[model samples]
Target: MILEIQNLHKVYNNGTHALKGVSFSVKEGEFLVVIGLSGSGKSTLLRSINRLIEPTSGTVRFLGKDITHIKGEELRKIKSQIGMVFQQFNLIKRRSVLSNVINGKLGSLGTFNSIIEKYSDEVYKEAYNCLDIVGIGDKAKVRSDSLSGGQQQRVAIARSLMQNPKLLLADEPVASLDPATSNSIMQYFERINKDFGTTVICNLHFLSLVRRYATRVIALKAGEIIYEGAPSDINEAWFKTIYGEEAEEVEIR
Candidate 1:
């Protein structure tokens, strides 16, 4: 398993129970999508994988190593193996796309060198290569904020690829894009999984987009997994089980 999340639970200091006994495993080259409403714990689940949000209980073992209890340098080193993308693009608005992409490798570089912007030629080359893979190579010199929502998300994807991670976690990656652009971005994610053997886990609000891209789907509600199965086996009834009366409120198409 690329990732093994066993009996995971997270409760915030403020007493918000984010995840409850969540358990799942992700395989190499798999494209998995998580669907849930705003407060359903999808973001928490994905962030917990990289320890951006630590679990209060349970083990998260990656490549046969338990990373849950590890801290400091050890934790940072392990987290570098996982890449994360977010809904907001999260790019430095003042920086060029290439600069933001290169920042992905900062975790692997010495602090002073990284802080001083002294990236090696190899790092720069790899950053540009990732941009090419994400179909944004031509925008390398442009400011990240100057791009459209879809293009900025692509730049963020390229930034994640620069880390050379084994697993990719995206939290509402295309939430800000239009339908057509969202489809294209999801296709790029699929291509990354198929061609690079990268494990992808994305949190999405769109059931149709999830069905179109994910091989496996996980549905969460009130911090619990209400459904877990192949995409083909999921339907409106399953959504109702997860969403209840609010099921009708969501626009899946």
Candidate 2:
């Protein structure tokens, strides 16, 4: 197993219970999709795994190490090994795509040094390679904000790959895009999972994308795991059970 979560739980300061003893294991190179309604602890769950939002109580074991409370350099080390993609497509708008991708090593290079550092030819090559992987090698010299929404998201993915992370966490990665663009953005993740052997744990709201891209599915409701199985197994009865009886199925395409 690449990751193991044993009896995880989280509660916010506002007194809302976010995650209720959620536990699951992930194998290496598996594309696992998380499905749930808004405020169902999907975002919280992803943040907790990377320690962006600490869990109220639980164990997050990655590569056989318990990373629930590690701090300082240790925490930074673990985080550097994990890449995260946000719904907002986090990127330095004023910077070039190549520069943003090179920033992926900021953690290892130290923030202070990164600001003044001069990258070598090898570093530039790697950044261009990452751009090529996302089908945006030609956009490297362009300002990040100048790219289209889908293209900007691709730049973010390229930046994440510069770290050569063992695992990638995508939180509502394509929620802001159109149906066609949503699938296009998702294909990059699928390619990364297959070609680079990176384990992906993505939070997705669209069942269509989940069925098309996810190898396995886990559904959450009110911070609890309601279902776990193959995407093909999410039949009509199971849909209502996961999304509630009154919820209507909406296809993206």
Q: How accurate locally, in lDDT, is each candidate?
A: 0.89, 0.93
Residue clash pairs of candidate 2:
none
Q: What does the lDDT read for residue 86 in candidate 1?
A: 96
lDDT of 2 by residue, 1-253 (tens): 9899988999999999999999999999999999999999999999999899889898999999999989999999999999999999999999998999998877677566577877778788989999999999998899999999899899999989988989999999999988999999999999999999999999999999999999999999999999999999999998998888998889986
For model 1, the stretches where C-alpha displacement exceeds 4 angstroms are 249-253
To one decimal, what is the Cα RMSD in angstroms of model 1 from the true structure?
1.5
lDDT of candidate 2?
Answer: 0.93
* Model 1 worst lDDT run, 10 consecutive residues: 244-253
RMSD of each: 1.5, 1.1
The alpha-carbon deviation from the true structure for residue 226 of candidate 2, after best TM-score superposition, in angstroms, is: 0.5
Residue pairs of candidate 1 with colliding backbone atoms: none
Local lDDT at 16 for model 2: 93
